[model samples]
Target chain A: MSDHLPSTARKPGLTSSAPSVVAAELDPPTPRKRKAPGPRHEDKRVAILRTAAQLFADNGYEATSLDKIADQLGMHKATLYHYVSNKESILYQCLVLSFGNLDAVMSEMEDRSVPPLQRLRQFAHSLALAQNNVFGRCLVLVGSRPLDMMPGGEIRQFQRRLDETVRALIVEGIADGSIKPCHPGLVSSMLFGSLNWVPRWYQEGGKLSIEQVVDSFMDVLTSGIAAPRR
Target chain B: MSDHLPSTARKPGLTSSAPSVVAAELDPPTPRKRKAPGPRHEDKRVAILRTAAQLFADNGYEATSLDKIADQLGMHKATLYHYVSNKESILYQCLVLSFGNLDAVMSEMEDRSVPPLQRLRQFAHSLALAQNNVFGRCLVLVGSRPLDMMPGGEIRQFQRRLDETVRALIVEGIADGSIKPCHPGLVSSMLFGSLNWVPRWYQEGGKLSIEQVVDSFMDVLTSGIAAPRR
Candidate 1:
């Protein structure tokens, strides 16, 4: 029972590892195999996370309470606590999920054997699509604020990784002559900022689709905003 | 007492011409004319606002209380409240101050006889400086959040004005054949996002000065990251 409970949602394993080992020894795992989380349980957990994320983005993280989230989801507070340890865990889950999607895009870029410029464009297109949704939008708008307040350095480390990945790509592009020579650091910040801002102004059910917006953004990024010299 | 309070800070006088007149008839003039706000009072008000802006930017607006701000300033909360109505007002003042500085730059650009491209460059330079400081940084970081939560629409109106100003500049640049033909709205969003992101990473005593960072950003915005054709 003690092994199952975490002190803080962020640092669940902070308590003695002895407790978990002792609990495992005492309980032999005979009937608990059937009690493990199933697909339905996982789906409910995801639903809670999705709802919490929208609430956090709509009302600020500090402004949002677990009670409000449960009420919004038409669930009891105890039921929400059953899935998530606390509000921070919900926030952490949302950010982790967002980072996972971005990492998947980065991995896709990495596996491709294309020119650096093409890789950059592909990354931009994928990022624009990712940011068009609520999860990605919250990651951008509320970015690092909620994480900065909570315990653990994982979120900040994730941010640094994202920065380094983009910066390295730009550097590679410049080295291969596929992209122009520019300060990679500044350019990465600019690129990420521009990409993240898409959901803020991108109108849903508007005339221009997400594809058009991403293309225009990529065009400005790649071809420059200045007209060609005569 | 009724005459002293305004309904909304942006449009304090919106409700009634009758209220002030009625209050004046009921009250006789007194020696309080000498207690009218002087330059010293105005300076104190500005100082309070400056401190509040820094606090709001560092810790979020909602998280920052008037009590904390007063404590930071070594004054009592009541004394601080005497200078401003509430935390929202402090945020509003910071935003208005930031907008005033940006507006001055825009006005200077308008007054100059330079070409539209030159004006755009100048505007970018001035914005970088303004944003590097506390007031402008708060305006960008806390941007429209507190204002949206408040009753007045002034901040949104201010945002629209800024959008119009930058969009018009881009339109002029394209017409003059200085800038490339692209969607002004998308380009403007990109440019502003990039500019607003400067304060996030710009170090005070780093190797590159503010001027260097601004120049590099402007260079990228103008020439872009793609290599020139032979």
Candidate 2:
């Protein structure tokens, strides 16, 4: 979804009194064009996505339909189509955004100045917070099972890239002697498994903040539950 | 579904030629009766459940139907009703069995003479292995979302009991000084989250055995991945 409005149109001055007089002097007033796609358009699209993701997470993917989403959004079915093509497309976008959050965390890891252990902790904190969002919860609860036959295969690619990134981080940690020697693949599975399961039990305004949960998990993951050997 | 066949009917001797002569001497021969529900009936019921679980895990519970399960098992759809009332019943049974496995682990933990940390490790190992089974995978993948409104509320109760058991173990470990002091709730969530996620990535005949996977998880849980402080 592209918005081709001029960059000058986005300036706050255009909507204020002083800039309008200057524009009037510059050129004769003409019939105003229909409202262009702008911030409001993007906001509405995000609203539709958020509503759809919540429904999909609360009710399952198979049980949630576009009509229900439209009803929830108080938009006509036809009007809803202007924002999202279909239910599957909404789900696809939600997953894309969900994985995009993880991808951003991985991108931040490219700054090698941070030690692997700290980078891993930062990644865990970011991932836990991301998964607390509606789209992230939808990604975990509804999952890609419904989209197995969907054409793009982008979901699978995102999954593979995520797996590789986690494993690579663990390997780096091991190499730098920050992480204990272990099976990177298995350790990554445990890490992802623990973090991904967070959505199933995590409550937004519950007792613990996302930071606290991540901190507890990181503590357990680093120091472990067992008492130190005498 | 109960099988009320006589205990004598279960004896292997009754199926053997030598036992038939002893039975003839014991009583006069009469008209043969219809075959009773014995080992074969139990075997068939287990077969139906296993087939249904596989279908539910692979195709999803919403997408899977009793007819499809029958087709996969090469049995008439009506015949499936004899073993399970409907798809919901099959899912309930699968969850019952899955939770039953966890309950058994908790029961094993009742032996308090073993230190709490050792008991926690045993619980982790048992949980990971249970999740590797088809029924366990069904519980994780298909879930109770489909049967949420089912009348009995057994599933919810089972989940609560499981949460309490894990938390209790963590508390006990902390009291005994076998485990590091931490928030039992957060630690238990992390523990269950990690173990429950096994069904997602674990392949039965993949590179690692269930024991190996469990061992790795136990290692991570006990010692963690961070290298020891100098």
Best-performing candidate as measured by TM-score = 1
Model 2, TM vs. native: 0.81
lDDT of 2 by residue, B65-167 (tens): 8889999989999888876677776776666555434655677777889877677788877777666677778888887888876655566676676677778
lDDT of 1 by residue, A23-54 (tens): 22222334436565555656777778778878
True contacts kept of 2: 0.71
Error of 2 at B132 (Å): 1.4
TM-score for each predicted model, relative to the true structure: 0.82, 0.81
* lDDT of model 2, residue A47: 79
True contacts kept of each: 0.65, 0.71
What alpha-carbon RMSD in Å does predicted model 2 have with respect to the real structure?
10.5
Using DockQ as the measure, the top candidate is 1
Candidate 1's docking class is: acceptable
Which TM-score values does chain B get in all models?
A: 0.79, 0.78
